[model samples]
Target chain A: MNSSSVAARGTVRVGPSGRYAWIALTAPLAIVLLLFLVVPILSLLRASFFEGDRSFNASGVSLEHYLRFLTDSYYLNVMLDTLGYGLATALLCLVLGFPTGYALARAKPHWRRWGLIIIILPLTLSLVIVVFGWLVVLGRQGLVNQVLVFTGLIDKPIRLLFNSPAVIIVLAQQFLPFMVLSVMSVVGHIDPTLEQASANLRANRWTTFRKVIVPLSLPGILSGLTLVFVLSVSAFITPRLIGGHRVQMLGSLIYEQIIVLLNWPFGAAMSAVLFTVTLTITLIVNKWLKSHPG
Target chain B: MQTRRTFLVSTVAAGAVLAAPAIVRAKPFDNVTLTLNGFGGDFDRIMKETVADPLKAETGLDVTYAPGGSSAAVAKTIATPDNPPFDIVLCDSPSVPELIKADMIDPVTPDKVPNVANLLPGLPEFGQHGVPFMISSSVITYNTEETQTPIASYADLARPDLEGRVALFNLENTGGVLYLLAMAEANGGGIDNIDPAFAALERIKPNIVTLTSSTVSLIQLFEQREATAGALWNGRVFAMQNAGQPMAMVAPSEGIYSLMSYYNPIKGTKHPEAVATYLNKALSDEAIGAIANFFRYGPTTTVDLPKAVADTIITFGPEGRAKIKTLDWTKIAEKRSGWIERFNRTMA
Candidate 1:
């Protein structure tokens, strides 16, 4: 290469001038995040520390709202229920998605395209539309009930919705694509020759999967778990629609506090608690993933 | 016999003299636009046709409608007191005290809105800070097809026959709170002593199919034959009956709680005069009558309606109005948060 080309390449790399160029390119995005995301979060945290009434007027800095939430068995149960739903949804997605993802990774290119499209089609639909669609399938006098009734399975329509299980099921369906995609990317990158070599050595398919494939795909599994769990815990609509008043999550509680009750300080405290719980779980998972590198 | 220049000058002087009074007599709020939050769907259409459109045509004052629920409007106003999104807020009875306590809405006086004089007696007692525009009540609503037994009173809801068929509004809804109060009153307790209400709710728990804040969900539940009966607004029941939904409503034997909506002018509104004018237009006999006829809601003002329309509205006229058991909304407002927490715990 010419000296001029070499000098240009050097400048384009991570040199002092290149670092400045990187900062210049990313500065607008950084400022936008600071204003929109970080500032709002900080304000939410501040709001949580104050004691307030029905109106938005803050009395003063106090941990009374947090104390109210923490001390109350109802609120604590709601928090635990939210985390439970998250875990259930993640596990359900993993159980269903892992197999589908492996098949997608192993399938022919054309078939894989169609499978991926099928997996992503639900994502394109509106959340409301999807929830309503589930309602149609799970509601009393719904299609499932009709089929069951026609086949003499039951004399009447059974209640299939308005419960935590329904919420987790709907949540898993809603976030399954993320799990599948995560698994597919990692498993697809894994060498097929490893599986062939294992078979040639007389190791069975299950043995190869359990020992070789799963350990190597640990990164994807952890990522999928984190994504699905966070999304499920933060979900308000599915729980509201499917679980009805029987199930109360922190997300819906915060919505009720702020929108229905018009109590911002209490709502903000609930939000902070939710955020802290989610962050702690994510950090722990990420740390474990780092320590047990795939 | 006059010169041309002299004739032209005299004509100009006469024209100026005639036009002076017209310019001085121009409406102060004419051509001014005000934004107000309102219930969307049919309510918005009827409101525009009866109130906004007529006002715009008459006075050149335009009203832009931002559709949302009453609580949402209150929440938005509370978020930004200095710069409210709406100049006028169409809010429920519970929101009035909240708005007044926060000083988020301007207080109405007879001087500000002349039509305040025409309002029904005792209607303004509940909402002194705003104009009480319309009235609905939490009535016993049941599906005629699905409900095997007729529901005549609130007590009927707790019957064993109605098990797994009732759809109720959550505590977040104004109708829900009204129902809770009605239950408390009927069962030997009231707002001050609300223990009986929870005890009553426990009995009715087996009957409740779902608790929701959505009117749409209630309608859907009724349509799907999942829910047979529950407490719902008279206006919604009327609409559903009109739409041939096999739904029927009755003023409960143990009296019904009034669901009143108000026109609250935001405190920091730029055009108070315009807001007053809009309220005046909305409260006019024509507008009130139109709203009553269409929505089957009782009007706040003393506007005569057809016999059929008046009969459909349970809160209309003296006899119908007597059926309404007034609530202590101020007390309700004060104890609302505690009640909500208690309710959530009970329901949970």
Candidate 2:
């Protein structure tokens, strides 16, 4: 009885000591985070309020840079465009990825592993290469046009090369895995019997999916949606390359400000805005996930 | 149990994802333990053989070199105003403003490097601030097989016949945009008046087969017979023509964007004198030839090129130089966002 009590005590998570050990274990990471992640972010925040030839210490802080982003319709349009793309990507990922996840989940063990790898093939290739490949296929002299012309599919090649839709499709393709992985992981945890039980109780397969599996996957779906949305919002390469400078995302804008224009403060402000907007959406989604029963 | 493992894995994965940009530093300076801070590619090698090895031979300074992806790499080094990380740096034209903004380039007075006189008069934008090392400019190019007429004008780039066969430069680089603006200027279109030309550009938009971000690939397209007509630098065109590609260069009826390459003495560098010696050598006739050979760009020296080569370059003649409109970088820098927005809206 005494030994059992001792073992129970051992199993208990220690409070501060556990945290201390965790901190110790992650100390290298913590130090790296402090110097790299934390410092740069803080520097970015500090930079937002100041422009060129301006000091950040005590005398130079201003609201002009933030105001500049807010007032500029070009930037505002881009922000809206990015948000639109993100939402579209999230929706498409859910629609396509759900079935793909279902296929993977229902597959035999060996096939499931292979299925998982095949799903991750896009992720394996470099983003630049993917964008370049897409460009070659989509451009004027690209293969699609040649093939289409040979087949007489249309009189002339449709402008698939550069547009917002191109960004949406590319982004959906890039981020589909995030949604699949999230929902698949959760679906794997679910007992198969619950689904069967619902179907066995005179419920159709669609009804079983609608009621049992879907409700259970709702939280995972929400999480995936939020993640994919945020990622799509900030994705620079796809929009920049595939969209042909038309699908301007907030990420590309930040890159321009930081790298091209050398407007660190403006870039930082833009980043802060991005971070806040993304975080707000994420929190709202998280709250929705919590309040609504899955 | 699997879910628990998955959660832990995801948490760690998220942490790493958050930490990625903070950790990897693009290998900082490549390969060698000690690094030389200059433009990468053959320039790095030339400096290694000529300057870096001898320095290491004398002082045991370990050195390698990194290529500038964009001007930002050089900008960050200038911002801190600390022990400047690069031993020496070969920067492009755009980086000049950044260093100027930071006041990081140690003002090399005439007292330091006497060979400063060799720089063409009123040439170095940053006064006594950097050693003027190399210079090159984009000359209009045409495919010999495709076009029968001489490609002499910026207006020629907008020909209806070349429609759908045109090539676009990478918008990401300063060079392409600058080239476009120079074309605009030649066509009696300043930034304010660029709309009609941009509208015309929209007509030619469908012909843009490849949008190359790489200058090498831009030149290579000429060699490969992939693109018919595009604005290419003289050096690249010459290199291609020499390599047996039937490419021709045009002295622009208007102008070209000249890339003036130079070595700026980063403030607080340990070896300013060494930097000066290297800069002096770089401007010298022999070193300029080496750079010219390496990059295929024209020399900064007043010495005349061979007649055959001079005939090929747009900036070769006094008349050509007079016609070229110099970009006021300050004005361009200030209203750049507006230009980009108009460009973005019209370009596609």
> Highest TM-score, which number?
1
Instruction: Give one digit per residue, the lDDT tens place, for model 2 in B69-97.
Output: 53656656755566666755567676666
| Global CA lDDT computed for model 2 | 0.70
The residue-by-residue lDDT of candidate 2 on A60-179, one tens digit each, is 778887888799887788788889889999999999998888777777899999989988999999997888777667655678877898899977765575578878888898999999
lDDT of 1 at A29: 100
User: Which of the CAPRI classes, incorrect, acceptable, medium or high, describes model 1?
Assistant: medium
For model 2 the local lDDT of residue A221 reads 87
Candidate 2 Cα outliers beyond 4 Å, as residue runs: A3-31, A51-59, A117-125, A140-159, B1-39, B42-62, B109-122, B142-151, B161-172, B180-229, B237-248, B284-286, B302-311, B316-338, B345-348
In angstroms, the error of model 1 at A137 is 2.7
The alpha-carbon deviation from the true structure for residue B195 of candidate 2, after best TM-score superposition, in angstroms, is 8.0
Q: For residues A197-238, write the lDDT of model 1, one tens digit per residue.
A: 989999999999998899988889989999999999999888
Give Cα distance to truth, residue A193, candidate 2, Å. 1.7
Q: Which stretch of 10 consecutive residues in model 2 chain A shows the poorest summed lDDT?
A: A50-59
